[model samples]
Target: MTAKPPTPVRRFGSIVGTVLTYVAIWLGLVLLIAGVGIRWFWGRITVRDMMISLQNVDLPAGYTREWQGFYGIVVAPLVIVLILAACHAGHALRVRTRRLGAWDQRPRRQRRRTRALSLGLALILVVTGASVFSSSVGLADFVRASRSTMDIGDYYAAPEVTGSENQRNIVNIYLESGEQTLSDTNLFEKDPYAPLEEQTSDWQSIEDYQQYQGGGWTMAGLVSSQCGIPLKGTIAPWYGGGNTAPPDSIRTYLQGTTCLGDVFKQQGYKNVFMGGARAEFASKDTFLQDHGYDEVKDLDLWKNSGESEKDFRPDWGLSDQRLLDHAKDEIDRLHAESEKTGQPFNLSMLTLDTHEPATAYDYCPVDTESRLISVYQCSMEQVAGYVDYMKDKGYLDDTAVVIQGDHLKHMTSSDSFHEQLDRNDHRSIVNRVWVPGQENKRRLRPGIDQLSMYPTLLEAAGLDIRDHSAGLGVSAFTDAIPGGSAQALGPRGYRELVATDSKDFYTRAWDGEEVHG
Candidate 1:
């Protein structure tokens, strides 16, 4: 007897169910791939951070190279879909052949083959679903921790610089993705930072400072250095779903936070921030403006100044050479204004040539195969030249210059560069203070965290902050003295402390529990 065909309603239901199953499977595969890929590419970032940062950040124009790691991910879904379709087609073909009495007496091997294929398909679907669910739970937990953390309100209290007598001008240079390890010849065949080491021998170096336990990105490093507090994703998006845009602006992210910029402003110092990248990107402008900076400038300013895109690279705004040139002009302008108004100035700039995944900028020297190494060499040259220019113009007469890397090298593909360095050695960010008068001063301690730079900058400007600490930080210089808390937390201890405290601290911080409190 021949079987009757299903009704129209039943047929429609079957098609809809099949379509929904395919869609669900595809969605699960994507979630699994994204979660795993993010962890692999950016190991230092938390899932919450990846969510929050991407909300306001766009991949740079030349970031295609960075996505090379994910080529497998792109092909994975198609492969899965094809396998599923092939299995279904094979089963349908076998059934149709049997119904036509052509395969009614199927061999035992064929029956076993069909059974194994069914099991394998079921296993794949089960594993994919489980992986997606697991990663989704992890992401949810991270968000919960972020939102339930203590409030950060009043964590960064304003320092009392009311009775300040000597206030020198400040010049801060933030080198992107720089590290002191570049100076170690063991890390590279040729010493990339030899020139920087030779020229800045008189500068104080803090080899012990830890970075990225609290925050890992550029803005995080900047906020940590200035406010002595790590930049964490405490604010959640207003949308109900994951990775949605936050209802509030980034400026309000740290509404009640105070930093060195605010302190400098209170002391009648003119604050200026300049960088080679866009000021608006990553909400850096908002952070700077919130901290009371004036005259914020970046690539937008450079472009508006009549410099065409002919000189600009799409990877990351302008080259370090152009940034330093513009910075010199800004410094000269600030100097003249300071002289006129009798107000000290704080001119801060972030260099971009060294940002990764490494690109070949104009400043990079010929014959260097590694763009990472070439950028470091270019950075040293630009910095040394800029220092000489400042000295020639007498800008250093009463100015304290702070030079530090925004964060440690972030490119995972730069494993070739790090292959020569000792495997056990802790990768460190660069922090050097060049106080005009105390040029010979150096910190002998093991290392310091980024937080210490806050008080160190204030100290370089001749502020006595010993009585009142710079938030959770101790001056790397002052802490070098015997018996200081920061001095006691040797490199190993500091690393352990950050690792132990970061999760709990960040959780409470997001919940509005002030660190100081």
Candidate 2:
């Protein structure tokens, strides 16, 4: 006898199960792709960095290739979902033609095949989920760090800056992905930094300039060196109020901390920042403004100033040539203003040509086989020219020029320097300091990291800092190590401390609350 039609409840349950199955499959595919894609694009990244990038979606020009990759990742899942939908629709149609009990009476081989397919998909989902959780999210590390007793706030030292009698003008330049390891002739065909190195031959170089944990990206590097603290996610997910969202979502970027700009501003310095990319990309503008910068000149400034689009690089914003040219003009104006009013100025700039997926500018010579190497050389040449201009104008006689890499190069699988960088064992940040009459005269303390730069930059600019400490950093210009300072932690301890979660300390920092041990 023919079976009665299935009840409404039964049909509803079946439909729910089918929908849930497809949802699970789609989620599984997305996780798998994202896990693999993130690794391919950025190698290994911190959860903090990942979360920050997600919240701040304004990517720089160097990420144009990555944008295309992201588009593929999004489309791939939809395509699979569509195919599955079609197959399920056809199956539903066939099932509709049979009695309710006939589905169970189907061939044993077909039923077994269906079960096997479901089991296979389930296995894939489980494996992908676990892999993504452990590696990409760093679940195990996070748990361990969360339970650790090390408190960053306890090690923190508030800056006590004393103005110098001369009050020298400051020129800070952040070179993108400027690892000194790239200069090793054993690894690379030639040193891309040769031109810039020649210009700063007399400048004091940091012998062991380490890239501390959490300072692996541009914003992090800027914050760490300037504010004397590693840039960490302020949000505590377990807590209800603190959410480490983008800078736009918040009122201020690290309002609780005192930075280089703040100190300079308090010293009556007219602080300004210029860059080859959008200042808003990673909330760099917000950080600068929050930290007492008087003005910001970025991609928007170049665009709005009626500069031709042809002058700008298609990937980021402008070439190093144009950026340095404008920088010269800016310094001239700032210098003239400083001469008129007794107020010194701080001119800070960030170069962008050496960023990943490097593009060759029209002015760059094809001296090297690798486009990355050529672009780096061209960027250095432009920077060297700027340095010469500063020297010619006699700014170097009074100005303190600090040049350093923002971070180590992010070597993806596709990067030209990946293999070479991987082979190197002693990679370090490239840095040079020019302190007025003390050019190449003052010796920086060895084994210092970016954290030490906060006080070092201040001291270089003719300021006297109490205890030779600011935040966790002890001034690298002094041989004396302050008790309970980051330098006193030693290399391994300092590294481990910075790598810890330090959730409460960071939360206080983000909340603009005074943190105590």
| lDDT values, one for every candidate | 0.65, 0.79
Q: Which candidate is the best by lDDT?
A: 2
Question: lDDT tens string, model 1, 161-200?
Answer: 5446776888999988777777666556466667666777
Model 2 lDDT per residue over 1-517, tens place: 4334557885686577667667777777777777776665555555655655665455346656457556655778778978988997887678857745254455556655775677578568857855884586555555555567887888888888765786789999999998888898888879999999999998888887988765677887898899888877655412212123254334567777788998898998999999989988767888899899999999988989888777787778887889999999999999999889978999999999999787777788777778888889999999999999999999988889999999888654455676666445588999988998744497888768888899998888788888888878888888998777767876656755786767778877778776543
TM-score against native, each model = 0.67, 0.74
User: Candidate 2: which stretches are off by over 4 Å?
Assistant: 1-143, 236-249, 515-517
- Clashing pairs for model 2 are 61-315
lDDT of 2 at 441: 92
Error of 1 at 36 (Å): 12
The positional error of residue 128 in candidate 2, measured at the CA in angstroms, is 18
